[model samples]
Each structure stands twice: as C-alpha cells, then as structure tokens.
Target chain A: MNSIHDMGGMHGFGRVEREVNEPVFHAPWEGRVMALYRALGFLQFWTIDGGRAAIESLPPQTYLTASYYARWLMGLERSLARSGIVGADEIAAGRSLRPARSHPHIMTASDVANLQRGNFERPTASPARFKPGERVRTLNLNPETHTRLPRYARDKEGLVEAVHGCHVFPDTAAIGAGENPQWLYTVVFTGRQLWGADADPTLSVSIEAFEPYLAPV
Target chain B: MGDDHKHDHEHPDHSQLGEMQARVRALESILTEKGYVDRSTLDLIVDTYETKVGPRNGARIVARSWTDPEFKARLLSDATAAANSLGFPNPVGAHLIAVENTPQTHNLVVCTLCSCYPWEVLGLPPVWYKSAPYRSRAVIEPRAVLAEFGVELPENTRIRVWDSTAETRFLVLPMRPPGTEGWSEQRLADLVTRDSMIGAGLVRGP
Candidate 1:
C-alpha cells in the first residue's frame, strides 16, 4: 500500500535529534505497550508482517500524530479486534466482556525467550530463478493492501548482488494470503538509477527483493 | 485569555497524558486477567533489552573484528556465523551483512518499509532510528541526514545506503580511527558508538 509509512524518499520532517543518554522507553506506558505488543504475538493471531501492515494502514493523520508506542498500541488493538480475541467495547470499557477464548496455551514465562526468534524460512523445492551478476527489474506494483515493496524502488532496474535462500514472503503473508515463500536476492541499484541525474554516480543502494518483485532485465 | 490563565490551558495536557496512561494500564490489566500476558515476564524481557543486552554486544564484535584479521575476514564474508562464533547468534529475521566503510566508500542502513534492525546484536533500536524523519530522509538524502548526526564525509567518498527490505540487516564496519593501531579490544570498543555501527556517526578518537 502507498501509505504514509512508506517514507523512503519524501522529506522535510526535520533533523534526527540525538538524545544524550536515551532510555529504552521514554515513558512507563511505552514499556507496557511494547510488552503488550510482543505478548500478543504469542497468540499467532497475526504474523509480524501483519502487525507492521496494521501500523502502516493507520490513517495518515494518526500515523503522523501518534507516538511510536501509540502506533504499536493501535496495531495491537486492531489485530485483537480483527481476530475476535477482544471486542471493541471491551477495549473501550477497559475490561474483558467474557471468559477468555481458549488459545494455544497462553505463552508462559518459559516461552518468552524463544518467541519470534524461530526460523521464518519455508523450504522451497525449486532452485533460484536469478543468480548473482544477473540484471533484473523490479515490478512496479501499487497494491491497496499490505505490501513490503517501498514506493521508491518500484520499476527500477538493478543487478543481483547475492541470492539468499527462500523465505516466507511478506507481501502475501501480511494479508492472510499464505507464506508464498520465494527466493530473496540482494539487488544493487545505482543511486543514479533510483534517484536520477542529481544522484552521485558512484553511490549505490542495495535492496533485498523477493523473487516475485523481480524479472530479467 | 489573561496572563494568570496560562496554567488553565495546560491542564488539558496533563489530563490527556493521564488518560493515555490510564488506557495503557487498562489494557495491561485486561491482558493479564485473560492470561495472555505475564507482567513479570514482560518486565523481564523489557529489562533485558533496556539494561543487559545492547550495542555493547555489537561493539565487542566490532572491536574484535578491528583487532583480529581472521575474525574480520569471517565477519565480512559470513556475518551470521561470525556472530555465532563470538557467542552472538543471529536472532530471528536478522541475517546480518557487515559492510566495510573504506576511505572511498561509506555505508548507511535504513528500513524504509519498517524498522527492521538486528535486535539480538544491536539491541532495541533508538527512538530516532524509528522516527518518521530518519526513515524518510535516510535513503533520500543520507549525507544530509548523516551531517545532522555530525558525520561529514569528503565530497569524493561514495555513500552506499542499504535499504533493508527483507530479513538481511546490515551493520556498518566503520573504518578504524587513525592512531589506534595497538589499542586493546576493550579500549577499541569504547571508541565505537552505537551510531557508528549504524553508519550515522564515526568512531571518535581515543
């Protein structure tokens, strides 16, 4: 989706302010929200890609105004409500309306360490379609739903730098379209190719593109 | 509106903050009551990232690479295994690739689509790294962004920005500062800041 969150090339947001000594969470609520967001992942209601897409799907106004964790809280709420785990009134009234639905054994203390660190790669029987040093072009896609393809690199020509093994594709997985695993490649696009004549000739940008997004140039 | 009424206008700000805090508290309690989350375990995870695990892990790796040629070779060639060899397993989606910053080339990293950082190695990302400004401008004007972070490269040096569109996270192996030939790993690690490894800043002179 071409949302506000696809902030690859647009500008004028101002300087990157550096804090002298930054804490992990600026406020106590930030910590709680972060924990809730992570804890919700244990339910397997949505993929990590889904969580991100929810955040990206926020209204442009909310995306611009909300704090970092506020965005996380919103995404969590969205996932919960959409999945039927929690109702809208329950969230608004600050209480669960009914007995908790039976879930995959509620993640225990012992399970916290290994959560989300498991292998996301899905085995593929086919060999890679493109090899290193091969020229390829990114598909110019503009979808209305969740997509990992940033707007900046759409339709750009690049060289395959390296081929990573097949992994769960986020473009489909985020929207409940299945893993749709595909070969991933590190494609190198010159700055000029991406940004045009004003860009430095020697500079380059490498993007990890899914197989479906690329084609022989 | 009078001078003495300025405080009245600020009252809503405090109430708004209080409401947000109440909302977060409410959500936490509901999740706890439903058995979806354990408060203590959640605290444990947050505390681990807050205090125990951080850029220090990545710093040590960078310092070791700076001092050991064999380790550096492994780091550049195969970073995931190199990280594992040093007791730092590549976590989850983080298939790290260490890009060396030479006198001629510089490297910068950004996840334009999302904030996909190497959490196991570099720990939780900083607020700025996850900010809208950094995400938008890092790829569009990396030199300008780096300049704001106080990193200024020569005009002739090429800047390579790695947009982490997938699981392969990048770590910038910033060039060793001049006059640090025999520095111990411990001392070398001190010079490597979190930003240096992220390619936003350079290692300061010791």
Candidate 2:
C-alpha cells in the first residue's frame, strides 16, 4: 500500500537532528515496548512482515505523529486485535476479559537466552532470471496489499549489482499467502535516473529488489 | 483550566510520556494475563540489548578488517559467514553485506520502506536513521545529507546509498584514517563510531 512510511525522495521533512550520546532507549516504557515486540515474535504470534504491514497500515496522521516505539505499541495492539488473540473491548478495558487462548509456544527465560534473529532465506525454486551487471527495470506496482517496492523506485531502470539468492517475498508473507521466496537482487540506479535533472551526479541509489518487482529493461 | 496549572513547564512531554507508559504497561499486562508473554523474558530481552550487544561488535569487525586483508576479503565476499566466524551471526535468514568506503567512493545505508537494520552488528538504529528526513533525502541528495552530518566529500567522489528493502542488511566499512600507523586494533576499534558505520559520519583521524 502507498503510505507515508514509504518516504523515499519525497520532501518537506525538516533537517536531521542528532542527539549527543543518545541512550539505547529514551524511557523505561520504550524498552518495554521493544521487548514486547521481540517477545511477541518469540511466541510466533505474527511474522515480522506482518508486524511491518500493521505499522504501515496505520492512518497517515497517526503514522506521522507517533514516535518510533509508539508506532510499535500501536502496531502490536492492531496485530493482537486483528488476530483475535485479544479483543478490542479487552484492550479498551485495559485487561484480558476472556480465558487465555492456548499458543503453541510461550516466551520463557530459556527462550529469551536462546532468541535468534529470523532468517527469511529459503531454498531457491529456480535459477535467477537476472545476473550481476545486467540492466533491469523495476516494475511499476502499487498493490493494496503489503509490498516492499517503494513508490519512488517504481518504473525506474537500474543495473543489477549483485544477486542475493532467494528470500521470502514480503507481499505474500504479510498477507498469509506463503513464503513465496523469489530471487533477490541489489539494483543500482543513478541519482539522475531516480531524481531527474536536478539530482547530484555523484549520487547513486541501490535497492534490494525481489525478482517479482523487476523485469528486463 | 485547573489542570493547566499542574503542567510541568520544563518537561512539556510529561503527560504524553505518562500516557505512553500507561499504554505499554497495559498491553504487557494483557499479554501476561493471557499467558503469552513472561515478564522475566521481557526483562531479559531488554537487558540483552541494553548491555550485551551493540556497535562495539561492529567496531571490532571494522578494526579487524582494517588490520587483516584476508578477513576484509572474506567479509566483502561472504559477509554472513565472515561475521559468524567471529561469533556475530545475523538474525535468522538475513544476509549481511559489507560495503567498503574508498577514496573515490562512499557508501550509505537506509531503509526507505521501514527500519531494517543490521541489529546483530550495529545494534538498533538511531532515531535520525528511522526519521523521515534521512530516509526521504538520503537517496536523492546524499551529498547534502552528508554535509549536514559534517561529512563533506570531494565533488568527484561517488556516493552510493543502499536502501535495505529486502532481508539483506548493510554495514559501511569506513576507510581507515591515516597517521595511525602501527596502532593496535583496540585503538582503531575505539575510533570506529556507530555513525561512521551507518555512513552518516566519517571516521576521524587519531
């Protein structure tokens, strides 16, 4: 879905501010929110892609105004309610009203010690259609469902810098379709190609695009 | 309004912070009540990131790459295996790619669609990294963005912005600064800041 979160090349955001000696998190709650997000993942409540989709699906206004972890909190609530793990009324009441739903796994101290980062790579279904140094063009796509292709790079031509093997396609994974792994490539585009005549010539952009999002130029 | 007088003038975000605190606490309680989450597990997760893992891990890798050409070659060719050889495995199925910065070229990393970072190496991303300004402009006007970060490059040097839109994560291997000959890897590692690895800033000379 085309949302404010796909903020590549669009302007009007103010100057970047760097906080000196910034802590890992600002507040205690922020750490808890981060932990909750990871813990939820440990329990296999939702795929990482699904969590990202939930955050992207937020209304543009809320999406823009919410802080980083605040967005996480909102997405968690949305995912939980959507999956029927917790009811909307229960969230509103600030407590669980129904009996606990049995889950195949629950996060424990041992699980926390053994937590590992999710690997989306899968066995390739077929050989890669494109190769390094090959010219390719990104397909212009705007699906209502989850997609990794940013709006700015749509329909742009690029050179394949590297073929990153097969990985889970988020478009299918986010909607519960399946892993649907595709050949992923690192495609490089000149700044002029992406941003037009005013772009600085020294700039180049490379995006990791799945094969489904690209075609022969 | 009666409550207006109670507002803390110095800390304007006090109320908003309270609201956020309540919301997160409520959600944790709900999850715990449903037996989905353990409070101890949450504490452990937070503690792990807070103290155990961070950019020091990446700094060590960068410093080693600076001193050891073979390790650098392996890191460039197969970053995942190289990092794992040093006990720094990337999260599950994700691949790690190390883009080196040369005198004629530079590398920057961003996630335009969402905040995808090499957490196992560089830890969680900074606030500006996930902000709209950096994500929106880094690809189009990288020189200007680097200028804001005090990294003014020569006009002839090329800038490459890597938008991590897939499962692959990037780490910018900043060029080693000069005048630090015979320096120990520990000393070099101390000079490797997190910002330099993200391509937002350059490593300064000793």
Residues B1-206 of candidate 2: C-alpha lDDT, one tens digit per residue? 11122122112387888988887899899989889888998998899788867899889889999999999999999887777778743332248899999999999999998899888888888888888788888987888889899999999999999999988989999999998789999999999999999998899997
TM-score of chain A of 2: 0.97
Q: Pick the candidate with the highest lDDT.
A: 2
Docking class of 1: acceptable
The best candidate by DockQ is 2
Clashing pairs in 1: none
The docking category that best describes candidate 2 is medium
Off-target runs (Cα >4 Å) in candidate 2 are B1-12, B88-93
lDDT of each residue in A1-217, candidate 1, tens digit only = 9998898888667777666788888777777787777778867889988888889999987876777777888988888888887877899989988778777776666665554354566788799999999999999999988877788999999999998899889889899999889999999888889899998676788888999999898
| TM-score of every model versus the real structure | 0.93, 0.95
